[model samples]
Target: MGTPLLVAEDISISFGGIRALKGVDLTVEEGQIVCLAGENGCGKSTLVKIVSGVYTPSTGTISIGGDSFNALKPRQAIAEGVQVIYQDLSLFDHLSVAENIAINRLIHDGSVLSNRAEVQRIAAEQLERIGIDLDLDAPVSELSVANKQIVAICRALSMDARILFMDEPTTALTTNEVKRLLAIVLDLKKRGMAVVFISHKLDEVFEIADKITIFRDGSKVGDFTASELDEVSLSFHMTGREIVYNRYHRTRTEDQPLLEVRELSRADNYEDISFTVRPGDILGLTGLLGAGRTEIALSLFGLNRPDSGTILIDGKTAAITNPWDALDYGIALLPEDRKTQGLFGQQSVKTNITSTMLDRLLTPMRMISGRKEDALATELVHSMNVNNKDISVLVDNLSGGNQQKVVLGKWIGTEPRILILDSPTVGIDIGSKSEIYAKIHDLAADGIGIIFISDEPEEIVANCNRVLVMHEGSMITSLEEEDLRADGIKERLAEIISDPDSFAGTNSGARVQGEQA
Candidate 1:
């Protein structure tokens, strides 16, 4: 490795008697990509914030180019050529792309008057340096998620940053967008800039990381080169447990489907979709970002009404015009974005958990029954294995895993016959993921028909008894039983995602039936 550009030694920090970080050491060399990986609440963010001058470690020393400091302020870190791009990207939605790129430089240089032409010129130069092209005059709000991320990167580079940290950059990006972002990161590395990538996705870590450091429960577990570890070992290091894939097998009780969708069509989102989920079966829907998987889920949950289709529940036609109708029809949905779509962040855990079942918790006087609500919330929280013991605490105070559990608890409390989980374990940790998978299996065994949607092949293979693959707003293929167990599922999925046109010829039938063993 070349000379070390950023070194953080023996970092320790605590808050309100709780240790957030403990004796963590991190180093980034010139022209190298280091990945910092850990489960949620594992101190990865704290350590990075310490290095980037957002947090002052209780005990540590950070050195940049042989210069040491006990702590740094925001301006000081920027002056030292350090930049951080958070998950939110932190761009002004109302401003133009050019203004967003050049605002940092203008603020740093104490510019008195705004110059539109100079801002566009600065943005053009930065974009040219990064080998990307975009309309500078376009408002940031109109840009896609991937383009917003690009603007964030250009904004950092405009400040002449030598060390860059990207936190969970690919969480919301499409497959192609992720690849483009990684290519840009590699180009920066080749230019002698140090890059620190923080993400929960192992495939990405292996693809772009030169070295990796793992954190667990506020301590550094170990560090290794990319070749030294695989996904399983890396998961173990992150969560201190082995993640075994135990596929759930369903025992068919009756031929009658619990929920059936026939000829479901939503203009640009999906077309000619048909599927059936039996009681105690976990049906997985997977596809690329814009493949209409989510739109189908939204239709099922009544968030998006289908243009033309028939939904049958218990062999009877159903009309679902809104979420309330869906709920009345014994259906529940756990959305993909928990923070925005699922939880009532400022409310108490008990309130969030019991939000869906408030009608049942009403008293004879028409007022809510507080005692009954508490008991029901308590039982659901325990059933879902929520980490927070006190149900009275606000949901926002919990970790990512617990917040997700709260969402599940809320929906499961509704006692729906059909439950649709959209990317349930997106930001959760390994241990929590295993727990959630087990919970899903248990739910199915209790005769709840589950519709599971995800983009990860391993998750589908592990927990689902049947799989449906979608591409370009249509169902490409369906795998069941042994077909789902085939080792080539990932390869097939890759082909479908990377080259949709090549797979279209094989889609002679709308849904290919899989053999049952």
Candidate 2:
């Protein structure tokens, strides 16, 4: 390979007493895919954060094209042609594709201040280069996650970035979309652009990578050519310890659905959404981003009002006018966006956990005692396996997985009859994911109806008794028992999206039943 576009040596990062990255070494050859594989807390994100200038390494050297860049700041890193596409893709959805792509140029207001047409032309060219032919004026929010990711790639390419870092690029992409994105990555590699691909999916890594590095507990396990690794070995390296990747083949309870939504319509977002979540049963919802998975959860949790529908709780029609109303009806929700919607970042871990149960903690004086609060909080923190030195610690300081645990812990403490978790394992480690799944299983076993909404299909198929597929604001179809495979669900969802009326009774058709978008 030609001179490496970027190389980092002995990168070490520490957070207080915890060493997030220890002696981690990596290299990105020009026009090549370099994959960093590890469990969530194994320093993959931390390493990428260092490369992207979001975090400074405690000890390390980062060189761009053989030039040392130890002190490079984020803007400086981008200026030097380094781009990090985060898990969310970092695109502001409200803006048009053209505006999102041309952001940097707009920020600089360069000497060509009067050349607005030229800027648009350049953005259009970048889009074309990335094989995206969408309307430049189209709203990014309207774009599918796969298309949005391509738009992000176009924006980075617009910067003329020398090296691009993709973090879990396909976490939300369908198989076809994933293939298309990979083709684009390969095309970029052919065009001599370096790529650092970080993913939880090993098959994608093996398919795309030239070199692979595994990190465990902030330390590098080993680095080798793609030819030197396989799924078994790569996974073995990721977790560092033996793990049994077992899923409950069938965890359904014969109990009928305790919660039912009928003819739920939410205007333009989702339409005629209907599904049943059974008590002592785990009902999983899966779809692409903007596929109405989260939308359905939010609507059921009273975060959004359905234009018209009947939400039946325990076979009884109920009005969930607000979240408090949902809570009053024994419904609890763990929102998708944790920092904003899930947790109060500034509060203590204890306080965050107990906020959902004030009435239980109150005295006859209607006041909560700090001691009772601490006791309850301590029990929950331990139960959820939230990692924190002290219950008094601010929740903001904990890792993403711990924060997520706290979010679930908050709702779990409420003892709701119905629990809805939206992407509950988004940022959690494999260990934590197992823990959370166990908790979900335990809850389901206890007769608490659970709605598990996730972008990961395997997860839905594995943990849930029934898989509900939503698209364009409605629960289009559902898969049970033998038909809940990821590919099967996507096909079914697409068919329904094309014509909900047409695919009403078809059992996951392979035939194209509706108009393509």
Candidate 3:
């Protein structure tokens, strides 16, 4: 390995009596791709922020090249060739791609004039440097998630970044987009740039990381080469425990389905989709991005009303015009994007957990009873294994996994008989995922049907008794029982996605009524 490009020693930081990080050390060599793996709130972000000069560590030192500093400002970090692409990307949505890429450099150079041509020229050169092609004149808002990420990388290159840090970079991308981003990271490493990749996806980390650093509860667990770790071992290190997952088995109380959708269709989103979720069944919905998986869940939860469809709850046609209507019918949706669609981040965990069931906690006077609210929140949090000891803590203060738990708690507290979980475990650590899988199985055992939507085939294969595959906003096929192995599902999904025409004639014996390709 080459000389260390960046070295951090004894890094520690505290916020209002909470030690967010403690005595963490990290070293990244030139051309190294070091992946920081940990559960949310485990000091990964804290250490990265300290290293990138967004936060000055209460104690410790950072060394870049041959120089060491007790603390560095953001500008000083930039001057030392450090750049961070945060999860949000931090790009101006209204600006053109060229402007977003070149605006930083123009400001750093103190160029006051708004020069569109100059911006395009600089943006093109940066894109060329990275060997990525993107339209310079396209508005940033119009770019795909993948292209926006490429633009972000080009923007970092424009600043002459020697070491780059990408935080959860692929959380919002499609499978192909993730592959492309990993290739770009590899290309960057080949070009001798030290990269710190922070992510919860163990598959991506195993694919690209040269070195892996594990963190748990504000401290380093250990650091090892990627060859030294597998997914289970890596998960153990992050969570300080072994997580064993068992395949799901159906345990329904009745022969009839708890919820059924017939000929569901919505303009520009989904078409001719039909499915059924029996009591105690964990129905997996697998699809690529924009396959209308989320849209279907939304319609089921009454967030989006289908133009032509019938929703049957307990074999009776139900009219679900809004979330309230859905809840009244004992249906709940844990949306894909928890940060926006699920949790009120600024509110307390108790508030978020009880937000969905305010009516049930009302007193004789019809006023919200604080005691009843606290009791319900505490019960749900305890039952859901939420990691917070203090229920009054703001939801924003919790880690991503805990925040997700709070969201689940909120829905489960509503006493929903049918739950629609859209990417329920997205962006959470592996340990948390195992816990969630266990909880889902437990929920199934209690006769609450679940519609589990995710892009990951492994999750579907492991957790669902039945799986539905969607393509081009339609249910193309379904797999059940013996047909739900990972390899088989992956092969079938690949065939359908790669050549939809090949399966147009072959039914595969898994067709449902109103299913369209």
Candidate 4:
């Protein structure tokens, strides 16, 4: 390892009376990947903001490339080759890839002239530097999430960034996409650039980190070499407690099915999908990217229309052609991308919690009843264990886990018989994930059928009593009974997903459904 590229000592910051960061210290060496692990609101983002000059710390000293500054301005940080890629990526959606890569440099250099050839050359150079190939003329909106991430990296390199800070970079990527991106980060490290990574996913953290720094409750817990820490120990440091997860097993009280889909078909999306969610059953739906798991969820939620299918709720055929119709039929969907599709970030927590049941809170004058809304919000918040003392605070001000809880409260307020949670724990810390899993188990215990959709085998194995694997818009395998309850069920499901044919003839009661299977 080379000399430290950047260091911050005794970093402390506050927002009003809240101490966002307290006595946190961080050091990043050249060619090193330092992963910051913590629960949401544990000072990781605040530290990043302090380092990148977004927020001036109340006390600290930042030393970058042997130059010390008590406080750095945003432009000064950029001049020192510090670049941060936020979760959003913050690219121009309408601009071409080449323009998006070169525009920041052009603006920084105060260039007013249009030079298409120059922009393409610069973009090509950055892409070549990172060993990536992207269509220069393709608009940013047209790229996949993984491709957009690569573009963001290239753009950062175009600014001559010596140190890169990435926040939750793989929250939306598939396993394959995450592997590819990690490979690129390794290559960058090989070229002697420093990377500061922040993520809630521990497997990725252990895979890519040379050093691990953990924080909890606005304080730095400790920093250790990656070789000295494992997932359990790291999670303990992050949450200040041991995190234990038990596999969920359902105890059913009713034999009647809560939801049943027969011959559900949507061209280019999903086909011949058949499954049943019984009362108290947490059925898992999983597959790789574009495997139609989410497409199936959307169809059930009435966001996507199917060509031919029969949806039976409580043994009666129901026509759910829209979201309202689906809600009326006692179906609620917790969408995959909670930040975009689920919560209203700009709205207050109270409003977000009571959003789905506003009709029940209206008064005789047809105006919203504040008293009723407050009562319902209080009930849901307490039930969901949301950690906000003020319900009037904007949902955006809460942490990712809390925001997710609010979204859950919103959907639960509808009192649905069937709930579909699509990637509900993505980008959430281990502590928060455990709480959410317990809540899911409790809801199932209350006789609400759950259709859990995720790409991670461990999550599926831990939470579901039955699982359906999809591939290429087709149901490939069905695992139930002892197959789901076995000791190595997680590994078995992973193997099946990677190569379904290998398990096709096994005597484990696994059924191969589609032509691909």
TM-score for predicted model 4 compared with the true structure: 0.95
Candidate 3, which segments miss by more than 4 Å at Cα?
A: 486-517
Flag clash pairs in model 2. Answer: 270-473, 271-473
Give the clashing residue pairs of candidate 3, or none.
Answer: none
**CA lDDT of every candidate:** 0.88, 0.79, 0.87, 0.89
For all predicted structures, in order, the TM-scores are 0.95, 0.85, 0.95, 0.95
Off by over 4 Å in 4: 495-517
Q: Weakest 10 consecutive residues, lDDT, candidate 4? A: 508-517
Q: What are the RMSDs of all candidates, in order? A: 2.2, 4.5, 3.0, 3.0
lDDT of 4 by residue, 30-122 (tens): 999999999999999999988899999999899999999988888889888899999999999999999999998898888998599989998
The true-versus-predicted C-alpha distance at residue 338 of model 2, in Å, is 2.1
Error of 2 at 111 (Å): 3.8
lDDT of 1 by residue, 1-517 (tens): 5899999999999988999999889999999999998888999988888887899999989999888999999898999999999988999999999999999999999998879888999999999999999999999999988999999999999999999999989877767788899999999999999999998788999999999999999999988999999988998899888987578989758658999999999999999898999999999988787889899999988889999989999989999889999998899999989999999899999999999998989998988999999999999989989987799999998888889999998998888999999999887777788888998899999889999998777787788988888887888777777776666765665555556665664552444332222
Q: Give model 2's TM-score versus the native structure.
A: 0.85
> After TM-score superposition, what is the CA distance of residue 235 in candidate 1 from its true location, in Å?
1.7
- Cα error, residue 470 of model 2, in Å, equals 3.2
